[model samples]
Target chain A: MEAKLLLQDHIAKTASITDEQFDYVYSHFKPLFFKKGQTIIISGDKVDCEYFVVSGCLKAFFINDEIKMYILQFAMPTWWTSDYSALYNQTKATINIDCITDAEVLCLSNDDREKLCKEFHQVEHFFRWRTNKGYIASQKRLLSFMNNNVKIRYEELLALYPQLYNLVPKHLIAAYLGVSRETLSRLYASH
Target chain B: MEAKLLLQDHIAKTASITDEQFDYVYSHFKPLFFKKGQTIIISGDKVDCEYFVVSGCLKAFFINDEIKMYILQFAMPTWWTSDYSALYNQTKATINIDCITDAEVLCLSNDDREKLCKEFHQVEHFFRWRTNKGYIASQKRLLSFMNNNVKIRYEELLALYPQLYNLVPKHLIAAYLGVSRETLSRLYASH
Candidate 1:
């Protein structure tokens, strides 16, 4: 699908926007492509834009003091990803985002997003709806982590992103679940 | 401060609304009081409204199958809490919210919120900004959890909610940090 149509469809799900309005909103987005493993945002760099995935996948992740990488989110097609904390707070990124596979994304600057939202009530509604969903997903993930039931977490993750099994590397999946590679293998075998 | 003023000030920080608009927006909220330990939402009950804390604190939490509680959020004055997934999706609550101390809250039903957002662009912007902050905080908490740095998590928690030390019980604090009471005591002593 074209980036324009994909974004239009995604936005249409939450907000009612005419073609003219969507075109004006979409004009602010710059389409960009990344090769697999290409970094989008690096820790300590200033974050200015958030990417709306048009094709392929990207991972927003963190590496703690021990150098162990933890996957915070996998941005699949039509999904948005960024170091949002950094973007909103106007601070340096504390997390990194990179492509999981060669990907195409529509990049929207923070300023333009605010401008569009201010200009269009529907755009504001669309973003509020988007953030609400993100907040819910994050809350759900937190509960899943605290539950400490690996089997259930594994099941929930797969249910939420069924294509992940084949699309994402096993090690990355393990990191997302905070499980050992061996443990992930066991879950995979049982399934 | 009164509930209306408190909520109005919070909104003003992110949005510009005329006094008439603010009052009209505020009219939909139903103020309710809860005694300490009073439950607001229970697992399996349908959630309809989200609460904005006017005074006192509330805990939004979940209990796993084994019956261990994990505090997802501590809703302080000016903060919002609900089983948002259930409230937004119109599903049964998977979490519970209760007063940690005697509390006053302004409840806005999902219908009212959507109606207000549709009617007021500033209200939509205010909510989008609010949810963006919530989403960021939740993501940061998830990172702190995955980092497994208990000391950092403890510091961050206290920094974020300095009043919580005097207001909330030690056990609940421990649950929020995902630590044992003994560890919490050690953190307290170290502080």
Candidate 2:
């Protein structure tokens, strides 16, 4: 299926919009291709775009004083990725996003996305619902961290996104799961 | 100021609505009163209402198997509180919200809020903007938890909500900061 079709499918699940409206929505975000290991965005760079991952993988991380990168998001096919704080604030990003695999992603600049949102209520509605989903997921994640054991968390993660193992690197996945890579490996081997 | 004026102020922050539209928005939520230490919504109960605090404080928490309650939100005046998972799914709540002070809140049901969103695009816009604020705050918090020392985090907490110290119990404030009471008291004394 085409990336535009997939984007439309995702939008349709949340709100109804006509083909003409969808076309307008599609126009706001341009397609950007990247080779594996390419940095799409870096810390202190001005954020001009939010990428919609049509295929392949992108990882966003921040390096702390310990010189370790803490992964914040891993974008796979059908996921959206960006330095959201920078995207919203129009400031330099403290985090960096890199293509971890050769990727084709739909990109939308801040101004164009805002224009699209203002142009059509459908577009705004779609984004509103998307934000809702992200909010609930993140809240549930914090709750999981506070309450669930590692094994239980792993089970819940699997139940929520079955394809995560195949799409993401194990260590990166482990980091996202808030567990050490060794523990993740042991868990995988044991199960 | 009256509750209606506060509603206008809240909506006016993002978008302007006509008097009629404001009235329509206002009709969805009924005014409610809560005493300190009152349990507004318990886990496993049908969460039919989302409260908007006009004054005072409220906290949301989940009780673990060890019976430890982990605080989620410490809502002050002008804040919105809801068990959103249940609000979206119409299921029993997974978290309990309790008033931490005598509070006057406006309660809106999921159905009414949905209808308002569908009928009034302006209302949708307001909520979209509100949700985005929550999203940005959460991202900052997640990063802070990973990188910031407890003292620094405590300082940031106070900087963000200075009134919290006098308005709420130190222990509850500590819980919201994701620290212990002793730690917070020490930080408070040192600072």
Candidate 3:
């Protein structure tokens, strides 16, 4: 499917908009492609745009002082990814986003997003709904981490991205669960 | 300050609205008061409204199957609280919200919020910006949890809620940090 249709379908699920309105909204997005292992965002770099994945996968992650990596999110098709804190607040990115596989995405700049939202009330409604879902997912993830039930967390990880296992490496999955590679192996064995 | 004034001020920071519009928005919010220890929401309850704090504190939390409590958020004055996953999705609450102190709040039903957003473009923009901030904060908390540096988490907690130490009990604070009471005491001693 084309990137424009993908985005339009995603937005239509949340907000009702005419084709002309969607075209106006779509005009603001710039399509970009990335090869596997390509870095889209790096820590300490200015982040101005967020990507809506049209195909393939990308990971938003951070590396601590000890060089331990933690995956914050995986952007599959139709999922949005960015160092949103940096993008929204105009701060330097503290996390990096990179393609896990060769990927295509529609990139929307912060300024353009705000402008579109202002121009179209439905656009604002769509974004509010989008952010609301993101907030709930993040909160749920935080709760899962705090709950410390590895079994439940593993189940949730699978439920969140059933296709992820084939696409992403085990080590990255371990990082995402905040568990050791050994622990992840044990969980996989049990599964 | 009145609940109306508080909400108006908070909305003004993110959006522009005429006094009449503000009044219309304010009308949708029904004022409610709660005594300390009173539960506003519980797991499995149908969640209908989201509260905007006028004064006092509230905690949004979950109790695991082991009966261990984890505090997901502390909603201070000017903050909002609800089982948002339930509120937005029209599902049973998986989390609980309760007052930590005698509190006054303005509650907006999910339907009224949607109605107001549809009626006013600026109202939708305000909510979009509001949810955007919440999404960022939740993501940051998840990153902090994954990083697993207690000292850094403690500092970040303080930065997030300056008056938290004075207001909330130690055990609850420990739960919020996903640490034991002894560990919390040690962190306090170091501070």
lDDT of 2 by residue, A113-173 (tens): 7787777787778888888877776677777766747887788877776877787788877
Residue pairs with colliding backbones in model 1 are none
Cα lDDT tens digits for candidate 3, A49-111: 999999999999999878999999999998999999999999999999999999999999999
Stretches of model 2 off by over 4 angstroms after superposition: none
> Between 2 and 3, whose TM-score is larger?
3
For model 3, how does the per-residue alpha-carbon lDDT over B35-85 read when each residue is reduced to its tens digit?
Answer: 999999999999999999999999999999899999999999998889999
**What lDDT does candidate 1 reach at residue A38?**
99
RMSD after CA superposition, every candidate:
0.8, 1.7, 1.0
Using lDDT as the measure, name the better of candidate 2 and candidate 3: 3
In candidate 2, what are the lDDT values of residues B22-99, reduced to their tens digit? 987897779988798899999999988888889888998887777777777788778888888788878889999998
Candidate 1 on B1-191: residue-level lDDT in tens? 99999999999999999999998999999999999999999999999999999999999998888888899999999999999999999999999999998999999999999999899888888999989999999999999999989999999999999999898899999999999999999999999
Provide the TM-score, chain A, model 1: 0.99
Q: TM-score, chain B only, every model?
A: 0.98, 0.93, 0.99
Docking class of 2: medium
Question: Against the true two-chain complex, what DockQ does each candidate achieve?
Answer: 0.94, 0.61, 0.92
Position A96, candidate 3: lDDT:
97
